[model samples]
Target: MKPFPVATALTIAGSDSGGGAGIQADLRTFSFHRVHGTSAVTAITAQNTRGVTRVDLLPPESVTAQVDAVASDMRVDAVKVGMLAQRPLIEAVADQLARVSLGPIVVDPVMVSRAGSQLIDNEAVEALRSRMLPLAAILTPNRHEAKLLAGMDIQTLEDMREAARRIHALGSRVVLVKGGGMPGALRGTDVWFDGTRMETLSVAPVDTPNTHGTGCTLSAAIAARLALGAPPLEAVRLAKEYVTSALRYPLAVGHGNGPIGHFFPLIHD
Candidate 1:
């Protein structure tokens, strides 16, 4: 007998050897959401919980080829994009996206690492903002990334609102400025805007140092929800809830910062 049907979500991102971020985290989140996961790796990183030590980018053609091979055979219901490390990769991914009409693309603009290190160059940032942002159905940028894209520091809630508005003007159907990195009580607050109405999603903060893949996990969950036929607002809400629950029980494996419990439902204490 044929297997039962399930929604499929594709991730176009870098590979994380540590299984905590990038494509690894995205695919893991997709599994948790019960969506069939597919991926096109743009770069590979020698990284673990400690940090990224080295990075190797695949050729632009190779990236596009992976996307092509998947699109030619499989039915991709939704897509999540992350960590295009350079301008060429950004342009290539943007070109591929423009060529095919994929379902809700969640752009998780992976510019800066959680530890405040700039992962991509200035030119790549411009490329992402100009080329990739325009194609995003939902653009998920944390405080630092929103600042970079919107050209302002995001410290207060008002800053997040303004940043979301500025990013929305860049052509995304929706913009979510995550305030997880905000100081004190503002943490875990996210501002969502879609040109006209703006709202804040406030969740009680999960205090854990093992939040390495939070960003990737959130975007992937959103894509999975989109694949499962949720509207944009509902998808974001579900994704936020998933991330918060995962953060409640983090995995205690690595030496440094660890991963959230993507399998929390199965292994919670």
Candidate 2:
């Protein structure tokens, strides 16, 4: 028999034609951590550093086919769950997740955009909260997403902690309330809660307009480390550091907002 793979990770996300976010960024992140990556593409997006122009969603059956094909053939050590744009897709993915024994599921709730836009309908959001959140081993949500999940505003660090607490009650084993949208020094401070313990994760904010794939990168990094056998909290901490370091060297790729360099460690200029 041949030697086994180092580790394997699966990304259930959309496709970004820009190659800066979604499955593209996720696969890049897993590669950076020396983990093998597989993917189930839920939607194909026409987008760039500027913004999304169009999106063509795949049928839930097609998404499930990809997921099943991977789960059946490979040993998925961890999973990074991203945008399921509708209630049907959310419920479908949730069902597939229940059937698979894939390791840790790091869920980046892509319910709200950085610009404060609701990406999904109320029913989709409800499906995510009711069906998907409970399946998450780690739920990473930005400020707006945290507010929506917790039903409160997150204006301070304590508010973030409380949001973590409230979202934890929603059934995710752990909740990470990201502070990337927070003001002042609070930015880049993420709160992690696992029902019993609450820990604050603060990294110096890297100011850059090239933050296109940050949310995707962070969650993918966490899943990569988890695939490599890191504990939940440690994985999150390391993922945040990875994202922070990546942001220090943003990729000036497009006309509008650029993207964070996924391979920044190899970038010398």
Computed on alpha carbons, the lDDT of every model, listed in order, comes to 0.92, 0.94
Itemize residue pairs with steric clashes in candidate 1.
Answer: none
Per lDDT, the best of the predicted structures is 2
Candidate 1 Cα outliers beyond 4 Å, as residue runs: none
Model 2 — which ten-residue stretch has the worst lDDT? 260-269
Writing each residue's lDDT as its tens digit, candidate 1 over 154-255 gives 879999999999999999999999988898888999999999889999999988999999999999999999999999999999999999999998999889
Per-model TM against the reference: 0.98, 0.98
**Model 2 lDDT at residue 65:** 97
RMSD of each: 0.9, 1.1
Candidate 2 residue pairs in clash (backbone atoms < 3 Å): none
Candidate 2 C-alpha lDDT tens digits along 84-199: 99999999999999988889899999999977899999999999999999999999999999999999988999999999999999999999999999999998899999999999
**RMSD (CA, angstroms), candidate 2:** 1.1
